[model samples]
Target: MKKLINKLLVNHSLIYKLFLYIATIILVVYLFPKGGQFKYEFQKGKPWQYENYYAPFDFAIQKTETEIENEKQQITQNSKHFFEYNEEIVERVKNEVTQKSTEVFQNSELSQEEKLDLNTRIATILATIYQYGYIEASSESKIEKAAITLRKGNKIEEIQPYKLFTSSQILNFLNSKIGTQPYTEVQNQLLNILYDAIKPNVSFDEVFTQKTLEENLNKISYTKGLVSENERIILKGDIVEGENLRVLNSIKNEFESQIWSKSNYNWIVFGYTILVALAFLMLFLFLRKYRLDIFENNNKVTFIFFNIILIVLLITIIVKYDAQYVYVAPIVILPLVLKAFFDARLGLFSHVLTVLLLGFIVPNSFEFIFLQIIAGIVTILTISELYKRANLFISVLQITFVYFIAYFAFSIIQEGNASNLNWEKFLYFALNGAATLFVLPLIYIFERLFGLISDESLKELSNTNSKLLRELAEKAPGTFQHSLQVANLAEASANEIHANAMLVRTGALYHDIGKMDNPMYFTENQSTNVNPHNELTPRDSAHIIINHIIKGVELAKKHHLPDRIIDFIRTHHGTSLVYYFYKKEEEYTGEDVDESYFQYPGPIPFSKETAILMMCDAVEAASKSIKEPTAQAFDALVEKIVNKQMEDGQFMNADITFKELQIIKKVLKKKLKNIYHLRIEYPE
Candidate 1:
């Protein structure tokens, strides 16, 4: 059973991928809020374009947000504030005042009768003030009316029209009754005496007030009067004003909220499944037809599907939470990122599929799809050569502008006037464009996650200032210069043949890093023409030369260079015979020599980029030996050397055509001639 399962997994991998892809999309769709989707798209202050609407059943009209807010305001304003009577505060103030009066009388030089008269007056004044409630001034602003409880010995009575006194009012009442002139010092003394005694008998009850307000607000009906079955709700061409638009929106919401019958749900799910399946099927078919390379690789296929699903899921989340800012979701990043690694067509296609899936959940499906599709196309057109920093900035700018234009045009069409256009939406577009700039960095992350390479990474690796390449120039200037010449030749040839010029150029730069290990032994770096090979036997010299390839692989691995770049080091020599050393060995021994002793340890060039690097390396090095340094001599040198390498079956594994090889030969001949100061057909 396990063997059978393994066989099934291997044999039906594409089917499994398709199943998973479909399942993921369906899962994301199910995760979205199924009720928010509305069939008709409407705008306020615009005439209803659809046919006359009617209520099919006795459904209540949903209230507008403005109406509900107005009702809540009424509830808040009319709700009476509750106040609790604190008899302890009143009694404490009275006791404090009595004690203060006693202290003042003791400090005064008045007789007992005068002090007694002053105490009696103070007691009368306190009684007058305590009769009214003293509330803290801060609480007075928050209360419209207060429910005050007056108590008289075991009997409680509720009072209305009770005037609450603030601290200032109490002081003012005391001063007016006690007389302000001639006894001003006494009055001031008494005011300071009463400062600590003033307290609020009535305190605002926030919990009670809030609870009452909420209960009142909850009593306000959310739904207005019901429309009977088959009643005409609104006629065609009627301008949807505040109340009418609210009713229409409410009916639409309630209609969408209703669940399908249990039996009918199967058909609904089936229909929804078919629609989504068709959309994804179109995307899959597009890949299968035009992008079979990506379709064949399961990782690339998974990456595409993952991006699509992620974008859709984000839109779904936005739609469920806040649909107005859906434009801020950075949908354009999809095309921008895909185009960064892949081509414009695949990027644009994937973006369209993502937008189409999102349309099911967002309001106004047609407008959403139209705007996103146009923005995606703009993204593809403006974004080119993303490796350059300026290109990304300019491309994002253009994409933002396109989004603004498309949205503005749609709004004008929908509203029939520019006056009603929501300009704030353009801010979301700007944010999206800014967010899309992150795709540049995200491209690096995607490369690591997917084991893919992009032009931006290639450009960075190709920099001469890079640590490894800089070390190569400093340590082995001769080999460094040779690598540069070969890079130019390979890049030119790759471009002519419609190959990855950046990849081939990068490969050429690092192809000869192994020569850096023994730069002095190579003829290019020797200043005095002292040959290192002279002291060594032919076999020893051959051994040193052949070991460079192996040393290069180790160095490349140590430097953490990509395997693609290391491939050039492994295949550049391509098991070719070291002709000079082998000939010398034959002359020294006068016997048939072992070919393995003279051949490079190689798997040979298995790709066009590595093959091109091999040819350019040999051609550039041999061109320096041309004594005449003329165009004809350079041409002869290039052809003779390239033909011999070809005859040795070095290029058998490389996926290069004969026609491409001829183009490469022509480019190399021209480049070599230019190197020798010969004026070829192509000008500098």
Candidate 2:
């Protein structure tokens, strides 16, 4: 079981990578829109590309949106208003008026007969006012022909609430009934009392009104008519307007909703799976062909796929609900992030594949693809230095501008006019651009998560003010100066060979940090003639020398340096034999020596940057021993030193070409001559 576990652990990269691809394929295939692709790609006002479309089955001719809206409005306008009767309000007002009338008659200076007549008249007027229902005043003078279930006393009577009277109508009725002149004071008092008592006893019932309106509207059949099977719906080049467009749209909707057999749906799923699988396959091939290092590193490949899946999943959700704002998803961030860690080519390729997959879900797939592809290209072009704060801002502006222009152009081509451009979409474009600026922090987070080093981190590490490098300089000044020269040589060669110069330079800066452990034991830091290694045996000295790689690795981890920089410490020696100590031991003891004791425990330099560092370290350290730094001597010394390391097979495992090594040798010779002030000969 332990052996099995070890085997699995050794080959975990292959296992997880396979799992990632399978999982991605499953996720995309499942999340993809299940409906079959609409066969025809016809747009409104554009000439049809296909032959005449015939009705597949006898289906209803549904109404257009405009027609449906108009019908709904008519139903609402014609629907009767509902009102509920409140007898309590009417009775309360009537009793109060009667009490007031009694008080008035009691305090009157009129005769008893006249008081009786005034009381009777007041009673009659109250009855009449209560008989007619009043409504809350509205802005429009609409006559509400309403029915009500009257709640009079304990008896509930189903009757008309009586013809509804507006405020003006009620005032006119009162004026006519209470005639002018003969008993002006009594009439005026009676009219004033009635007006004050007239509150709206009938209230609108919104719930019942809405329910009735919906029920009536539902009764209006949406299906106006049906078309026979095999009927020619519309001809090629025929304008689909008015009733023809409605029928065609109804056919489309019905066609979409029709359920197929389970087996047929399986076929649709299979087809969608093929398309999605192809998209991911393209990405895998791209990485395999052009970026094999990233392809081999499971973490890097995972980050790329994660970004792709995240973008696709977000777009899927957006299209599932509101597709109008799909453009606001910041899909361009995929390219920007990929470019940050890797290069522009990989970033743009991943982004294009992701956008194409999303194109299957978004509405107007053509326009969406066009807009997103253009934005992605712009992102790749404009975003050169991601670590620079201003570059990201400017790149985002360029991406947004590209989206704006592309969308505007596509809209013009489709709509044939700038007048109908969707000005609101520009807001979504700007929002997407602003959101893309968030990729900077995202790059940092991914760098931490995957144990990957980005250029931004490289720049920070290259600073001499950093705690680890500063300590190295302070404790061992000679070693620190040697590291600086090595960094310059490595960076120049890296640039010439099209490798990462910043990465190599950063690695070179911290490569010999372990030498700070026993500064005097190393020659560069040994200021006096007294040697620490002289008192120690050759084996002990070799052991100390070989352990610097180990100690350097420990210090780097303590200071929280990244793994990429730590690799330089691990591989700078590249398993080369420490010939000085081994030869010294052979001469003194005159016995067989174990080569392993004098060799570095190395997993060698596996990348070009690390390989370049190995060469630079050897060249710079050997140059310090050169007695006269002349041009011919410099050339011979560089060739001899580098050739010895090459013969020892130190660079075999490193992914450095012979030509790149040649370039490194040239760079080292020129840099050393410059350092030693070796002047060129001027012939007469």
Query: TM-scores of all models?
Result: 0.78, 0.83
Overall lDDT per candidate, in order of appearance:
0.81, 0.83
In model 2, where do residues sit more than 4 Å from their true spots?
1-13, 44-47, 60-85, 107-109, 120-227, 234-252, 586-593, 630-637, 673-684
Compared with the true structure, the alpha-carbon lDDT of candidate 1 equals 0.81
Model 1 C-alpha lDDT per residue in residues 556-672, reported as the tens digit of each score? 999878777888889998989888899999999999999999999888998788889898889988887777788788788888988998999999988889998999999998887
Predicted structure with the largest lDDT when compared to the true one = 2
Consecutive 10-residue window with the lowest summed lDDT within model 2 = 139-148
Candidate 2 all-Cα RMSD: 5.2
Cα deviation at 626, candidate 1, in Å, is 2.8
